[model samples]
Target chain A: MKNLLIFGVGLIGGSIALKVKKDAIFDRVIGVSRHNGRSLDDFVKKGMLDEIAVNVEEAISTANFIIIATPVAQTKNILKKIYPYLNADCLVTDVGSTKSEVMLDAAESLGDKFDQFIGSHPIAGSEKHGPDAADEKLFEGKNIIITPHSQANKVQLDCLWGFWECMGGIVSSMTPSQHDEIFSTVSHLPHLLAFALVNLINKKNSKDQLLEFAASGFRDFSRIAASSPEVWRDISLANKKAIISDLTLYKKEIDVLVEFIDNSQEGNLNDYLSKASSTRSEWAEDKK
Target chain B: MKNLLIFGVGLIGGSIALKVKKDAIFDRVIGVSRHNGRSLDDFVKKGMLDEIAVNVEEAISTANFIIIATPVAQTKNILKKIYPYLNADCLVTDVGSTKSEVMLDAAESLGDKFDQFIGSHPIAGSEKHGPDAADEKLFEGKNIIITPHSQANKVQLDCLWGFWECMGGIVSSMTPSQHDEIFSTVSHLPHLLAFALVNLINKKNSKDQLLEFAASGFRDFSRIAASSPEVWRDISLANKKAIISDLTLYKKEIDVLVEFIDNSQEGNLNDYLSKASSTRSEWAEDKK
Candidate 1:
């Protein structure tokens, strides 16, 4: 019987467990908790997992598929623990925001079995976390990116694509570098800006009073600032090079805008804002 | 009979018309369209306005209360137009995002009648616009800030407070400079950042490709970027000093974050993000 062993059954992993059980994709699904297993109890009570694996070695050895659904920082340690016990045909994949770093961690930790691993990022998440926040339909129609290294096993890569597809994700493949660059621009930079915006307000002498008047615009713009500190810290570090590059470019954009406002260049400022506004409006329209 | 004459029957004006009509707050509500009367047509047909003003002079002459809900750039011109015809007791107020500039405009245009004018900024709006997007419940439980000049008539100020309170607004008073400073930090800065971010993406060679993968975090964070160019241009210019100061402060925040990320200051970065995350979390929780 096929076995699916999931590491760190929080929002991402717990959702996967729920979906897998509903679809019966694997004969037995086992979870290994990263925390104190208090989060895992809900999944157990709900019958989302076939078992909570008490023995990591036994679970890894019997598993045909292993999914590492932990923070990027924990991926290397989890990879190291499972590498010795992994069967020859076991396909290992991880759901980490930054792929290049995770790819490096897998290469370092898995050694000879590195080809069996592929990096996946299901671009679906909420400010909320833990198993209690897991939703079975979280990945439905969401973009799930897979970043496979040059030495990745062709058969295992195909299996990884099918695995995400079966979870109702729109799966696409890209190189680890491409994945990191794209996400750094689209995701990492925005998160950093949000955190900084919140921190800027937090630093103000009138912070509490300022926050009291923050309306829907601030609410939506700062929503991502409420994301997990540890998770974002891991992402920020793992993808530092690309993120820093984007941040540098973004700072230049801000400086240009400031110059426009500073000089009272009404026409130039209007044109700049018009371009941004029209582009955003079109993007929002297209989203609908 | 008490008449409420509203200039620019768009989102803000139309919403005010709706609330006033539903509550029968005035004997007659008349609308003065800024554009062609096309947008005002639905409002008249829906019985939200008793009449669309045919003669600007007559409308101004008979009005007991005049609400200028037009864009900030047009406020000077609207005030200039109605100044000659305004009766001595006619209280004039505007719903502009920026207070100091609008206050200046009223001071310039109204001359001896300056005390009759009070600047009001209702801190409630949607990304949507025009009369069709108007809601009677728009001001329900929302903060309505009135920025009254020191020389302002106390009776007119009290009446203005009563007017907004009648429409279900929670009214508060502050000076024009204080209003500009508070909103500069909370609203204007966030908007400028959102616009700049969208423009950054627009400048990228892979704009469409990057936008395709921009998920919820990017979506929510950039939502304010879709605001009206003309409106934001007016706000940015009107509140230039405050906005620029905030932007400079925000840029420093960005620099600090970039330095943390660039040097791989893991502990410092984590602490910075944790503070933002926790502050945002507590604010969100309190909001609920």
Candidate 2:
């Protein structure tokens, strides 16, 4: 009988279990919770998981597939624990936001067994977290990126692609560095900016007053600021190099804008705004 | 019969016409279009306007009220054209985004008749513009800020308040400078940041590649970047002082975050993210 073991079954992990269970992808789905199995009780009750894992070694030894769904920071420790018991045929992957660090951690922790592990990032989530927030359709039509290192097992990599596809994700592959760089520009940088904007407002002496009139524009622009701090903190630290580089480039852009505004350079300002406005409108149109 | 003349009858003016016509608030609603009556013809056919004015001076001389619902840059020009025709009892106001500049334009163009003009900002809009986007309920339950200069007519100010309230707005008062300052932080600065971020991505050689992976977070954070360039350009210039000040402050916040990430200061980074996350979460909660 096939066994699928999920470590740290929160939103990402719980949702995967829900999808896998609904499709009967495995004979048994087991969850090894980071929260001492307390959160896994609901998953079992809902039939999303067959059982909560009491013995990590036993679960890893029997598993055909293992998914590390914890915050990126805990990935190394999870990989270390599972390495000793992982069967040769068992394939391991993670749903981490940043790929490079996870790839490095998997390499260090798994050693000779590193070829069994792959790095995957399903670009789907919400500000909400935990098992309660999990949905079977969380990944439907979403982008699931896999960053497979050169040493990864070919059969395992193909299986990982098939797993994400079966769960309705449009799976794509990229180099680990490429994934980090692209996400740093598209996701990480925007999140940091949102966080910074919110904190900027908080620093105001009239913070409550400023917030009172924040309106829809402010609401939408700052929505990501409400994301899980612990999760983002992990992402920020794990992807520090790319994020810092992007942030520095972003600061240069801000500087140009400030100069335009300070000098009342109307023509330059108009050109800058027009470029952004048109590009964003085109992107939004294509999305629709 | 009370006559209401609305110059530059686009989204804001067209919506006002719709509400006024629906409620029979005026005997006649005359539109003086910025697009030379082409847009107003449809409004007239739809019964949102009583007629399209051929002679601007005649319309202004006979009207009990005038709403200069044009772009901020056009406010001074519109004020200049109507000054010679405005009567003593005629109350004038505008639906401009920036209040201080509009207030200054009114003072400059209308001379002694400036007291007849109140600077108003209806804190309501969408990215969509033009007459087709007008909604009678656009101002329903929205904040209508009227920035009355200290030398303004009290009776006219009260009448202006009544007019907006009748149009389904919750009216409030503030000085023009205060209005500009608050909106500069809450609205203007966020807009510039969104614009800058989008432009930053566009500058990258891998722009389309990067944009391909911009998920919901980037979508929401950059949504305001899709706003009208012409409108935002005027706003950036009109409230340049306050927006520049806020942008400078925002840069400092970015610097602190960068330092934490660069130094691998996990605690500081976590603390920074935690503050933003909690503040945004609380604000979102309050919104609900």
Candidate 3:
């Protein structure tokens, strides 16, 4: 009977545990809560977790698999705390937005044991948070990118892939640097722009009336801005270099557009808008 | 029997025709298509329009209510064309995104008959265009702002309000300058940003990969970029002064945010994001 231990279970972690346990994928499941430990009590009350562990070290010896499901910022600290106690052959992985820093930190801190760590990020989330927000089918039909560590054992990497596959995720692999670079614009920059636009509108002289009449467009454009500030703060900082590059690039585009609008250059503005319009219409997206 | 002649019928005018015909708000409905004369035939075939008109002069003499549903850039020309034929008692209004320029042109060109024209913008729209996209209930529970001419008769303004109200629209009033300023930031700026961001992403080093991975966030964030290029081109150009001012203000906001992200200033980023997050949560919006 294999044991699966989940650390800092929130939306991502709790959902994984729920899905795995509901499917009876593992014999024993344990969760160590970092969010006030209140969620662990709820999990126990709800009969989801087989048990709860306060000290990760006490739980490490018995677990064959450890999933760190915390924010990316805490990845290094958590890995450091458990490395001395983790079972030699334990399959360790994480579900964080950024991968390069976490993988680098693991390589530096875990020494020869770096093979045990695999960096994975499931591109499925909503603005909601907390354990209660966890859904058993959260990862169903979603893309999960695993940033494989080169020194990691091949069999352990396969096992991690299988775990995500078993939980209904479509598994793919990419280097940590590639993952960060790709997501920097596709996800992080969009969130930053949304946040910035919302704040700009908020601070405007006509904010009260502006917000009052802000309809579906403003609502949809700024929806991601409603996300947890602390989480985004961590993400922007963790993935700073790539995100800054994206922001810088986007800044240039916006400046050029501003000139077109300012100069009332109709032809240039039309061509600029036509590019975006045609591109958006062509892009494959699941309809809202 | 009141005849409502709608020049430049597409989504906005066609929708008004459909709703008013459905409710029997007017005795006659006529649509002149800017996209094509074919849509007018379709509207008549669908029993939304009582007849189609090719010449605004031929239509204007008979219309008790004349709605200029053309693009903002065409407002001055349309006003010049129809003012010569309009009945003194007729209430002429427009459905354009920008109002100040249209109203100013109305005052300048309509000469002593400026009071016959009212600048109104229904705060309801969709990305879809043309007669096929028309919805009878589009104006239901939506706002329509009338930037009334100061020299306009109170009775004529009330008639204008009643006309929109008859189409199931709630009517309000504002100065043309006030309407332009508010919408420049809320409506025009968002569309500009969406377009610019989409183009920026399109021109990126990883356009294909970025788009393939673009999910719900990108979909919602870039939605307005899918708006009609010609329509937006006209709007941004027509309201150049106000939109440019807003673009500049938003540029400043983006610069400040870039500074934080570049410096990895987590504390300031958190607070800035927190303000937006909290504000969005408080605002009434459709759930993501």
Interface RMSD of 2: 0.7
List of clashing residue pairs for candidate 2: none
- Interface RMSD for each predicted structure: 0.7, 0.7, 1.0
Interface residue Cα RMSD of candidate 3 after superposition = 1.0
The DockQ-derived docking category for candidate 1 is high
After superposition of all CA atoms, the RMSD between model 2 and the true structure is 1.3
Model 3: per-residue lDDT, tens digit, A1-288? 799998877889889888988999999889987755565787877967888886668898778999988777778888888788888879889999888888988988777778899999998887788788999999988889999967878899899999999989989899999899989888888899888888988888788888877778888898888888988998888898998888778878878987888777878988999999999988844332
> Per-residue lDDT tens digits of candidate 2, residues B1-288?
899999877888888998999999999999986654455677788898889888889999999999988777888998999999999999999999889888888899999898899888999888778888989999998899999998888899999999999999999899999899999999998899999999999999999988888999999999999998889989998998999899899989889989998888889988999999999999999878
Consecutive 10-residue window with the lowest summed lDDT within model 3 chain B:
B33-42
TM-score of 3: 0.95
Write the residue-wise lDDT of candidate 1 on A171-239 in tens digits.
999998888888998898888899999999999998988888888999999999988888888888888
Scored by lDDT, model 1 comes in at 0.90
Error of 1 at A47 (Å): 1.6
Residue B35 CA displacement from its true place in model 1, Å: 5.2
Task: State how far residue B8 of model 3 sits from its true place (Å).
Answer: 2.5
